[model samples]
Target: MDPNAQPDRLSDLPDVLLVLIMSFLSFKERAQTNFLSKRWESLYLETRDLSFKESDFLTASVYANPIRWLKARADFVGYVRRLVDRIRDQPIETFGISISYPKPYLELIESLMAFAVQKRVKSLVLDFSNLVWRTYNDVNIEKLVVKIPQSVYDLTSLESLEVCACKDFDPSKLSKLGKLRSVSFGWMELTDLPPLLETSRLESLTMKECLVHDLEKISSVHLREVAIYNCDFYFMCIFNLPRVDIFKYRGDIMSFGFDQMNTIISEVELDFGAAEKKNDVSYDSYGIEAGMICEFLNNLLDEGRRTATTLTVCPFLLKVIPRSEHPHFLRPMKTKHLVLKTKLHPKEFNGIRLLLLTCPYLETLTIDLLPPSPIATASSYAGIDPQTYWMQNMSYWCLWEALTTVIVKNFVGGATELNIVKCMLRSVGERLERVELHMPFDLDESRKTFALAKSEMLQRSSMNVKVVVHNS
Candidate 1:
């Protein structure tokens, strides 16, 4: 060997380290290591993590020619079966299969699952959701009703299971997987999902873009975290989770209620996105009935007053406050940290004013201005004016007494944001310490201009307050 040549440190590593490194690669990539050397030929077999995605085998040309596609699918199945057979008695930690059309390959998939069960796999991920995008023109949709194999529910050794786009996966068929601690379901009908929450030992659950029809209640004692994003609900749902610590929800406002009112929660985030406009089409925003929105928020805040110390919400929550009917409608909040995802509109200011009156102990405040939405109808802007509303001398006890830190996100050096910042500074009671302005990525301003903006804010403060500007 040349003296200048590098040593083969990678090959010198122990077999356990090499197998562990190969475990992170896909099955095909791991198998390709067989060509490297005789010692590497069988090293891939000892890897306990197996991931086989059908897209790795099929190509664009195969898709264009049906015969080639069929042959490729057959070859992929045969190769996987042979590999699984070779490692039948080995202990597997995780097994994942991502196939496009599971309808025609149900038996093979089931056999693969059986192998995982026998090997005591700790995590299993079955992603048949790709079938939705791949079969738009190739296969009939009505005949593609794929369900999870019944063997999955019986896998007591499974600690985590994630199923995506299996359309007919009935939650009622879920048996008690005693060791299962985490589960995620995507793109399916979860009308019966409440049963799993009640029956399982799951500590974490996530659902995305699924249809929830008449999900009445979730009563869970073991569940600790839950995230529901972009899922459509038919009616109001009730939550009875006593031990849940972290909860997050996004999408259209859905009416909901909680059974345990006094239980303290760790954190909660509710984000109802701003409306959008595409071409000439107008997507309606914040369309829930006023009474329903009011009731929903009241219930949530009532719980938040006792349970949550940190809360994050969208401008829509502020826009719908029942100010006229009851001045003290909102219960006094104990929330110390508050995050407001807003648009800085006049109505949003009115709502913020109402909210500030209730949070007498707020320590930190964040105002994140969402990207501008399409112009709504004139009627939507009928009542409030941003300039006069924020400039008023009303007392915000939280800003005066307890507020120490403030963060403004998506700052554009606009008049609305500046005035809001001025208003907050004027109301500073003593505890207010630092204010940070996080500029947008596409801000059309120079460093000197940003420094001048920060200087202007500092000039508006009544006491010694630090103003920091971050231009992204």
Candidate 2:
């Protein structure tokens, strides 16, 4: 080669650097790079991260055709087996497989999992959505649910594990994988989770749409974050989670207890969306345990505890907080960021008022305004006006010295919504710096009302307060 000739920078790169670049691409893309040059031919084999998705091998039309779908599934399974065979002796840093076919590919899946365990794969994700299939005549072509092989438990090097659409998952099986740190399960059925806490070094846990029965206690010393989204559980107790800093729960929580969560929790989000009506008949018979829920929140948000600095609450939860338990609601919280997901109903504004009164150090407020539900608009309490009620207790409305930012989303600028915005602007006073209103695109006569509200809010805001209104 001539000295003046331009050098092939990519080809001349170090082998380790090449392999690192290949790891970011999908397995198919990485294999395609083999034809680039003789040096690149064997380079893909050294790639440590392997990701396989059935959709990558089949087109949408192929998936709709039963014959083509079956053929694609067979080809995908064969490819996976051959790939695993090649990398069986090598170490894999990460491995992920997502199969949406409703077929019993258990043998093929298990083979890959066993190989990964043998190779000491650190991160593993298995997503099998819609795994059961039936023909138009109701004849079952495949009726399968994932049962994780026992070999996976022996992968002590495993750091992260995510399983979706698995059935009858047991945490006890993970006892041997002491190095497991982060774990997530979706659409699964679990009897208990205490075993995972007692055995593994789990730091983060997430459960989505999972049915948990007899989940009595979750006592984890190493857990840092737990997110339970749209999960159904019989009863649960948080006996000991000393290190948890971020906690989020959505859906119906019939009964729960927080016994030893005294450490500083940075963020707490709770959304009990029509929990009372959605709960089981036996659970609904008792109705919302307002006292228990409020007591737990009071302890979690107490000034002395100083745990939660950020809080997010949905309007439905206000229905669960009985008026009889007003003292529990009065406990001062140290929260600086408050997010309210509510339809600006007059009754719901009372809850917001209570929060404003308690969170004295609130700095940032975010409101997700939604349309009032039929149940709310038709309720007897709908006529109760928050402004008139607050006027009577004017002494409770004090200046929020620390509040600076306000973000209102889905702003239709209805009467109740405008009142809420005005209340926040007046309450925050000179310290408030910015207010962002995200208005809906499909505005009716409320568009003019929104402009008026915006003007009024600016007048009530601080001298330097910047108000921004944009179509959402």
Candidate 3:
């Protein structure tokens, strides 16, 4: 084998490896590879998965001269058609297309989908958002959807489908595909999706900046995880979940219809803010506006049956949850690993404690304390606790059992911080164990916060907790 010597044949690499490489490439690149040699002429067609992107075509179609674009359009269309014909009748496991309709690319996309459907391609992903995000105010998939071949439903292997940012898409045929497993959507109204998507086998679903109207009915037969963000959802709806592990949603006054879940899902993620709506959903008409943010939290505290193991509260999302008064458990997590990260002085510490009080099985806590954005004198702070800034609540609560391990990050030695630690230690009583405090502070503040913690903590013993000091 010599570096200067050419290989005897390109086919020596094996067809399986070529198909794998082709799957990672876009349609245009795959087309270009066909010109490399006779052996590669059909290599692109052999690939069971394909992703044709309109942006790639348009980006390359541009030239310094407009005259060249007009002259080249016909040749480009002819070349693409030939490529599609090459793959016709081939066994396709997945056939997907993404279009950024900057100008007018729908015709090309429609022809492509027709070819894929004729071959009974299984999975499909139509992403029309790249153009919408750049030019339009919103994304809906209606104007771009076409009359797809009904035979698409006949593909039993069809499992995952993602339709994002189209004009308006009617998901009517999803129910016919019994083998479908996962569905992802964005910037589309919630149609009768349950009727369309045979979601009985759905494992994971994700929606972003979308809308859910009447939540319909979701039974936890095989659902594993659900994530919805920046969505307008139905209010006062009872969700019966059985065997769901993760449920994530964001909107104001989100009611947990968790009374009917058959088995507990492992993780639950949410945003503590009202979902702004341009359309009516059951959740919005119930007066769960931004002002009544705590009402959303109150509902979670009362409705959630399964406690979460991993809890993440977005501080920005939480600020919208009216902290003028302490809120108890916007649904607490029995998740052993609790991660608290905040930029606003965590005014929700007590609220978190109240929420977790119901979690009978929590083990570890990790706290990340972010410094306040700017200085606020005593007057600007007003009603906030002057010493610990632990909201205005004068209440006694233990965040979790004393046996729980506590890790505090960004621990600065300040009078306020020291008081907060002292107060927390007092609550632990005889249960406190190892506390890892990453305290970086001035000599006096560091010593005082440490001393207060030592004196106030009557938990297991002073030796159980140790403070790691870093000079600021």
Candidate 4:
């Protein structure tokens, strides 16, 4: 047989690996691939991941009456239900659904989750943010969050779930997923999150824009890493997680049992810029959590005997408090990897250098422009003209370049930003070896500057270097 010959009867790939590959595909793509042969048609149904995206709907668009759109949505959903209902054996791992234009309102989802329950889905992500915003004139944004059908909670095998841009997802629904290891909830009307406190195995959690009444509920013994945005961590004593390492969040951490943590955590990551964008109208340019994380870091260093391996911080709207507020304050850090990322407002840049001075053993240092994100869109469109379009872009570079390794992402290659980045690579880092500049676009001048920076760095740096240029 020729090496490039097509195989017979789907003998080309192993079933488990086939399922794994299948897991990464969209539901429509999976369905289309199934049509390639009989073996594949039934293979996807047996695979662990299943997704239904309303964007994949094949029905004709309706321009005038809402009833026509509803009917088409119903028909499209019925097609999905019929196909899933016939699967010989249920897939037992991942199940997902995204409704881009939900009309005839989720009666289809009621049936879909029932199928998911039968499939025993282990990881589930459901997005209902699309409420026919396109084509229909009767779209009501508020209806999207009113109350997700209660059947969503029936997925008992779910281990990781991300529900975005849709609502009425009472956290109580999570209690049914006994084995959940990670849970992320966003844009829901979550006033309190006591419901999530019970998930002991949760390793990574991201909460956004919810009213968190009790922060103490999140002190899970097994939570190893956490990222929160726009949500309130009401303040609770954080204890030692022998295993927990990375932590990131924004908004308010109102209270703390800082005195209780009994062990050294290997890493701390704090990010708050997007939140400043999200709560623009109510933007406390200096968030309460900004100081809280700094204090948390200093407190942990005070108690920890072991040096941190990685420390990442973003002080977006908030800066160091006045010395009078904490007269005896000392920066807490002794890490090999130190990252300071932000769009620096002059006021916010005050105490950053002092904090870096404490990380004497630091080996890897990165000073990044504020990262890009899909979530930040809400703020720019929030109807409030941003008080300062260039609010935090100006930064002091001389202080940042002193660290060993420098990596910059989202470098727009603006003269000022590039100068700041290049100055870091050439100046302070005598041992700088790996310099990565990932640009989103290809400009010949940028590449030339990169090479020039590399040459300049080689003359001064005391280490062998590999300069990587990643252009996207």
- Model 2 weakest lDDT span, ten residues long: 133-142
Q: State candidate 2's TM-score.
A: 0.72
Task: Assess every candidate by TM-score.
Answer: 0.71, 0.72, 0.62, 0.68
C-alpha lDDT of residue 288 in model 2: 36
Better of 2 and 3 by lDDT: 2
lDDT score, residue 242, model 4?
47
How many Å off is the CA of 246 in candidate 1?
2.1
Question: Tens digits of per-residue lDDT for model 4 on 421-453?
Answer: 454554554455676665545447855576456
lDDT by residue for model 2 (129-179), tens:
653432112222134366777777667889999987665567778866877
- What residue pairs clash in candidate 2, if any at all? none
List lDDT for all candidates, in order: 0.72, 0.71, 0.57, 0.58
- The residue pairs in collision within model 1 are 264-307, 400-429
Quick one: best lDDT, which candidate?
1
lDDT string for model 3 (29-68, tens) is 8878888887687777688887766555655546445677
Candidate rank order under lDDT = 1, 2, 4, 3
Whose lDDT is higher: candidate 1's or candidate 2's?
1
- Report the number of clashing residue pairs per model: 2, 0, 31, 1
